[model samples]
Target chain A: MIEVKELVKSYGVTGVLRGLNLTAPNGQVLVLLGPNGAGKTTLLRILATLTKSDSGTATIHGMDVAKNGELVRQSIGVVMHSPMLYGDMTVSENLAFFARMFGLPSPDRRIAELLQRVEMDRRADIRVRLLSHGQQKRVALARAMLHSPRTLLLDEPESGLDQRARCILEGIINEFRSADRSVIMTTHQIELGLQVADSVAALERGRVALHEPASAIDIAQLQARFSEPTEALGAL
Target chain B: MAEFHSERGSGDQTETAPTSEQQDSGSPGVFVASLGVIWAIARKDLLLELRNRDVIVSIAGFVLLVFAIFTFAIDIQQADNAELVGPGVLWAGIAFAGVIGLNRAFSLEMERDTLEGLMLTPISRDLIFLGKALGNLMFLAISIAIALPVFAVLFNLVVFRLELLAIAVLLVIGFSSVGTLFAAMSVRVRAREIMLPLLFLPVVAPLLLASIEATADLVAGDSWSEMSQWLQLAIGFDIVFVIVSAVIFQFILED
Candidate 1:
């Protein structure tokens, strides 16, 4: 679903991604577990075609993300911070706009189905600004799914959600895999990430320090590896 | 149906999935669909403005207050020669209000971080520029409508003439063309509010001078045919600036 190699991205002297390579195949969720400033967001942005890498090759399926950005955009769904939704528009209005943009057929029916799936049908008419943070987050989730994207890239989906909201997020991720869609997500939560992810990896110092199946690794060891800084980071 | 298709170092066969973009782009009604995206973006902005009433109301209030103050402070109303002063005061007030409106064009996107969402749509940046510039132009036009009667009464001048309307449209279109581009650039920097006017003054110096002079001529009873050169200059700049700004805007908005 996603393939990246030698992705070196930097901001002036401060490097964010250094020779990072990772992959997430179809029908699975890949969770990137990392500490603060681990370049997880930058990696996702590259895959989402929201930002360019300084050097390296990253492709979704086979299309180069930088060269075929328009095609890549048409295939993937993205969830970033703060919902990325207009506060003044109603939830339904927001979905309808994207639906039209995606050239979705039968948009009203699709909007209804997504809203019902997210348990947000009751509040579809309410303005986004009036909703609580969790509700707005749910709307954001629905908006991302409105186009039925094949690859889902979410950056920190569990940041401020309540337990119920987190469960909905996990359910959505699971549903993606069940439908043969691939998922790439970044989070610091070990237990929650492992529960939903089929594969797990840790990014440190702009490099992938570890990549393994979630079922193979011991949780405690995984936590320890993620928490400590690597002395080999500078050398790499 | 939406699986990824990649090209590796060597020839390799992978599961081929068709791209919907080719289908959509090749369809018979693509032009209409493109227009739909443009109108959707512009409509969202206008609706947001209508709901908040921030930019238009504040701009109108500020411009009207400036006009009234200039009328009293400069005594343009009592001048034995109001024409000489009226155009200067009018353009200054309009220019100030226009800048404030333009500055909000991209700051609102930055405020909500909705820019990334727009980018992900893969809509052409040229269309984004057109939609935003149109929205800015509409807001300025609304402000002008609200301020005109009050401006005329305060300065004791006739702002209802056809030539005045023509000059106003040309000025607003020219300002919006350049202002939208600068506003997009300035919002990415710190101190965007101060940055907006500073970037604006130098770029629009010639346009503003022509605008003020032309307004002075019309107010001084010069016929449109007589001031054809000034009108032609404004029209020419409007064409060149708008096209140039639209072309250059995509570079400024790069991720």
Candidate 2:
């Protein structure tokens, strides 16, 4: 389980997250819905142990995100909008490099299996520079899952992907769910989020405007919640 | 069928059991794994350079050109002073070529966003710095190997002396060590092409002077005892800069 209590994060003079609280239990997908500059990326980066929070406590399972960052990194996998892939290397080589960095047991087989899972086995030998944007995204996805992490934090995983690529991604997320892994993804694709997310949290002015299960809210309610304009308020 | 394939794919009997140990010990294995990561990055760079031949070729060509220019400017054959001036000419060639290679080495990473991917991995930033430094050192060594013979042939100097060889190694170590660290820092800054040489040359001036002096003594056929003090200074510079660079590289990289 992940519990964020009174989380507060600021950039210079501006506060992005203001006493925001959220909870996500195991075996559930929580989609954070918000428009631009809603602090969605900031919140996810903090959760992924890439950025720091000014004042708050985020605990993954029982470990504190700030105090026990290495532990948090070990348990979580993050796939941001940027592919974070080396263009000069082959697809399988990229996966193997990451797996080796994390010291995965049997990295060779793990890399091969991930390639097959992402359905990039046929192009595994080709340099990433030759692959399309969507193919690179698949490789990035496989790279993120190399360690079999428990918590998956994806920021715009479906962005820039075609319909076929979107289906491949949805299939991977469903696989994560069946493995009993917890996932938190932020996406603008409301239809895709509705199809897979078990719960949804909408953010406005760095606060949770709506937090409920997907079954509890219909499409109209979600649209209304997301479309509400944020007031220009000073930092808390 | 999917489940069966997943189970068989893992090949571990404990595939059904949870990997609780890994979760409990979050980073115990990471430190050891970092060594492998460092080796892999350096190996990849080395292999790529070997295949493409751009860095090596450019460096060698640049060194040869510098030597040729110096030969015309200095009139080596007319004067019996070739031996006295040979060391300065060789170091000038190496230093100029070293800067070019260092700049190109780092630009390779910047061109493709490879450095970003490397940084996102769960390894210490220092290891990344070290790996790149090692790669630069190897490339510089190769450049020296090709240039040293050309220098001997062009200047009509005997190149097979043990003292000369040792002094060459020391000079290479001093030049490339500082070059690698400064190159890593400068590559990320704005206007990096102009910034790298400006940042590197000033900081590395003392080592360069010391190397040129030591090499001049060796080429003059001075005894080891006579040149020992200068050699110590060169060694001291290399050790100090390498340690300081390793400690401060993480800060630069983070910024």
lDDT per residue for candidate 2 within A79-161, as digits (tens), equals 88777776677888778777665555566766777788778889999988889888888888888777677778899888667
* Model 2 ranges with Cα > 4 A deviation: A4-21, A52-59, A64-68, A204-209, A217-236, B1-34, B78-81, B171-177
Model 1: lDDT of residue B170 = 92
lDDT of 1 by residue, B159-212 (tens): 698988888899889888899999998998889889999998688777777788
Which candidate should be chosen as best, given TM-score against the real structure?
1
DockQ of each: 0.30, 0.24
Candidate 2 residue lDDT tens string, B161-226: 887677767776766668778888888788887888898888877777777787777777778888
Q: List where candidate 1 sits over 4 angstroms from the true fold.
A: A228-236, B1-28, B77-80
Q: Kindly report the fnat of each predicted structure, to 2 decimals.
A: 0.32, 0.17
Query: Candidate 2 at B71: error in angstroms?
Result: 2.2
lDDT of 2: 0.75
Of candidate 1 chain B, the 10-residue stretch with the lowest lDDT total is: B6-15
